[model samples]
Target chain A: MTAAATGVRATARIVARDDGRGGTSLPVLEGDGPLALRRTRGSGDEAHVMLVGAMSGPLGGDHFAVRAGVEAGARLRVGSAAATIALPGQAKGEARYDVRLTVADGAELRWLPEQLISAGGSDLRVTTHADLAATARLVLREEQVLGRVGEEPGRLVSRLVVRIEGRTLLDQELDCGPGAPGGWDGPAVLGGHRAVGQAVVVRPEFEDRPVSARVLGEGAAVVPLAGPAALVTAVAPDALRLRRVLDEALKSLG
Target chain B: MSRAALLVLADGRFPAGGHAHSGGAEAAVKAGRVTGAASLEDFCRGRLHTAGRVSAALAAAAVLGVDPVRLDAAADARTPSPALRATARKLGRQLMRAARATWPSSELDALAREFPKGAHQPVVLGLAARAAGLGALDAAYCAAYESVSGPASATVRLLSLDPFDATGVLARLAPELDLVADQAVEAARECVDAGVDALPAASAPLLEISAEAHAAWAVRLFAS
Candidate 1:
């Protein structure tokens, strides 16, 4: 309950720069506590990195963060080894995870993390902020599973904010599980669905020829933002179905 | 300033083009999620806390003298569906015309000139409230009440449900409307200092997804 008792305060930082041979390389890879970073093999101009959870955490009171930057002409792809599960801990305070990403001009970043499962009796808050240059390309995806199989959810609040050239492209928050405001799981909100996911694609090419807005399926939709980006949002009865909806939408975006 | 202004702005027949849109209720009804008064109440409650809360906060902020341009951008940020954004702007434009003709304030005129096409409806609603001499809480109440009322009224026509039942739904939600309006005022106060980022960002994913689908409906009763 106290600030000191609130778990670990750890941050992982990564920097990707141009290799000058038509490729990209990571010069800075640092992670602390349970937030482990590993650079894996990548082909061509893209560098691949996988986030390996050093330990089971993001439990109650735990504080974690990941920061990544891609310089001009460099490309980086980040993924997780497995799903990040929020678990209840000894402390009563909620856990916090912050992801800050930056892509400079002519740079590219693909941030595709696995689902975040909010287990029963656990509480977590996640904030992901991405700042991109006008010419930067980004493919960011987020998926959340309310609770494990045959379990009730705790509390999970997630916020996603994306900006380009100092202008707001998209900013939204979703609060689900226990203690959230009323009607969150009702017909107009989740409609009894347990899984929710969204993908955002931004490219300079979209500025010239924008993506048309349309409904993907019964539970998904793709809509163009004010900037050169498109957002796909989908909700399903389960994670597998949710991924199917998002994957189908991504293929159409291509 | 005057309490009567809230009544004028919140009236369903204000000619702001809200009659054509069901605020996502049409899609819910078609999806079979809303079968009767009970389901309608459930749907309206969800909408009120999410989309309704966001709108009330924006309107309250506008009445508190926050810049309309900034609030308009903030509104755009909260609304992900292009169809919903277009609908908001169209309604904002219509409300701007009515407000300018009725209240005739310089701030409203300036905002109209700035956004020729239109701004977001909540921002315009706040300015309209201010133009009519209403306060922040009043603007918040108007926005919060309208969020549920629009859908309730639309459902009566969509399902041919008894009008009395629909009215009862709104009546039962009156207490929640007061609570949401108070919360909106609190958020608007934060916006006055911390900027629009302080406003609530609660979202209704099903509504956004359904609105996109409804927009493509070759034949539908409501516009959104």
Candidate 2:
């Protein structure tokens, strides 16, 4: 084997608790390596957290993880300041980013990370998993841009798995860019689109009256899941249009 | 395993209710993406690899004695679109009728009873293949081939193009089909050890997106 950089391994954890004074408290806020977590102001009782990059290079061969937990009656929203770029590094191994989210009874979590851009000559595989209690609520959004401007995309594989109680809500994996299966850019797949986004909203109220399936606009559609959740998937020629489609779909979902 | 049974299971006219759905080709055709044989070939190839790959692995795993209930849940997890899920179950229900009449296996009957509305088509297909004395590879081949063949035939009817051209498209994709089927079987083997998470989850976003749109069409030639 050729000599190469071993890669960076980082883990960040955040836990939101229901404070007695009608607000949420972050009793556990931890960060390591390139994953920097900071607690910012949130509206009302919600606790907001922003992910700030401490350094570049989730490049090839990196291992990163983020775990967020919301206790009963707590509300937490997580977002990133900017898009995370996956770049090629000295090593040939694929980068790994795993996100684990948990919402307790009567808790709510909004995971709205910015888009992750896969740059040329990079390989990144991301898996996001969320487990919710029966009465929990979650809004999770994921957007991926295949490549930077004016270049072919590297290999990118992303999977999102969400479960409520003990039942699966939505589980899907999208593989794209170079070394992916053929026809990924074909009409039936991305249709020459370089950006793809999905948003999953879960609320207990949906159990009584589920959301109807509808197309938000061109390149986007929202459909209710078998569980008390609705999933909106959108693809566009670029990141801007993709975000727009998801925004409109979220509005309609609201 | 019976080689002839594989052929019978893979037959297009197997009365599985697949004829009503265009497999997303109707939307692609209306969008002017699949105008003729060349574009249809491209479209079929896309389905063959993404959706096709996933379906084949699920089918192959089902043939490997995986629990039908768990496999059905896995299939549900893989399919994000409700319309496509409904179509798959509808086709699965229809295929269940055809398979039980032909093979009369207890597994198929039990699964049918469990999912009275229907299980996913790929899961039913694997059970059907098992009832027909076929192997995992055979199930995978059938699933992968149908992924492309359905779109091709649908395009033929939607565009009213020559059937021979559609057949040719399938012929050209024969080698890739074999490769995908083999990959699916390999993944299925891993699932036997590592669980359903080992199965490939490749998805075609456009197909899932357009299937929702196609389902809302006021007047459409195909069901999906």
Candidate 3:
């Protein structure tokens, strides 16, 4: 599918299938620009893709959204091509992107996207909601860099809500302002950290595990990954290594 | 006259075995998901709406003698993390012992006999709250507070914060206490009327991952 025209309302739909051989594949449906799909060789048939688009010229403020819906008993591996830059808005200095996903019973969705950079005075919000049937599985990753590179830092107000069976599972509101108190400033919270990210993996397979603890560090301490069906989170400096570690860990899960 | 009793239930040192678990804070801290008091507050707030509220509501119903078996099942469905379920059972056991000592009743004894493995903490806690002459709202508030404060107070020791500062944090969180407690009471009433099986299931995936990771850790300060 060709990429959508610049400044045009655009929507991308990608459907993935479980090959029944413990592998997954994505087949692009309507899209524009460059959306490449392939399977990782000798890696238990993991689906891989790269989505690249142009933002230059009259296409400013053009919105992009992706909807991925998985069928029952299917497994999917989803990711992005490059870091998404939320360009300065025409009026508010920002752009918007939305991602919606659904996983069916006995199916799994592994969604990992690159860090999003929102320029100073930019306004952006990404909301991801997933509906899971009984026994469905999901692994979602989202990373945000609040400001531009080596410039006056910008502000990013983000809200993330996830629900299953019409019930809210995770509802997060992050407002990062300059010198916000009791926010990212204290010793036990975000502290002085600028880059923030989260990865979540859910399946009934690990239902015997407990839900409370002090510290969960095993395998690698500095990288920030968790679980038997481990998900990873890391700052920009460690993101690449964390990604590699995550890929290796996920590969081992099969 | 029972204001002292309410205070005891609300106190951070109630010894309901809360200090033994971090309510997913420890795992989040280890993962760098939460670092200090401020972030901890945010995490607590998020939970107050999700798992914390669900547990509080279920507990309120249980205290009202709504039906232990159904409440347990509903709680099991709502709690996706296996680690959390075990912790609930453990906390339930401790709460039962304390509840029996404070106010023993045949209903409590029967519920204990029916589920020797240990009832879900919320279910037992609700019963205990009712036995103590607390209303559904109070039961919900106490449950929600314990749910968050258990971890907050635990983090104080785990992160080595001053007790005074820890209590201050709790005091600051007091306003939210009423908000979530009200939500829980309303939700519990709805669930009880609808039947436990009809209760909504709300599970936080990241929190679940943290709990699973914590369970697998070789060295852990808390049992959760």
- Pick the lDDT winner: 1
Q: Score the docking of each candidate (DockQ).
A: 0.87, 0.80, 0.09
Best by DockQ: 1
Off by over 4 Å in 2: A1-4
**Compared with the true structure, what per-residue lDDT tens digits does model 3 show for residues A1-254?**
22343333456777767777777656544464423333433245545544455443112345557778777777777766677765554432234466778887788777877777655655554556666666778877776665665543344545554556654454443445342222332222333444566565666664454223322233221111122223333333334544554454444344
Could you estimate the TM-score for every candidate?
Answer: 0.97, 0.96, 0.61
RMSD per candidate (Å) reads 1.7, 2.2, 7.3
Clashes of each: 2, 0, 21
Q: Put the candidates in DockQ order, highest first.
A: 1, 2, 3
Q: How large is the interface RMSD of each prediction? A: 0.7, 1.1, 8.5
Better of 1 and 2 by TM-score: 1
Q: What is the lDDT of residue A236 in candidate 3?
A: 32
Global lDDT of each model?
0.92, 0.90, 0.62
Candidate 1 residue A171 C-alpha distance from true site, Å: 0.8
Residue-by-residue lDDT tens digits, candidate 3, B82-160: 5677778888888888788877878778878887878888888888877777778878888878867866777787777
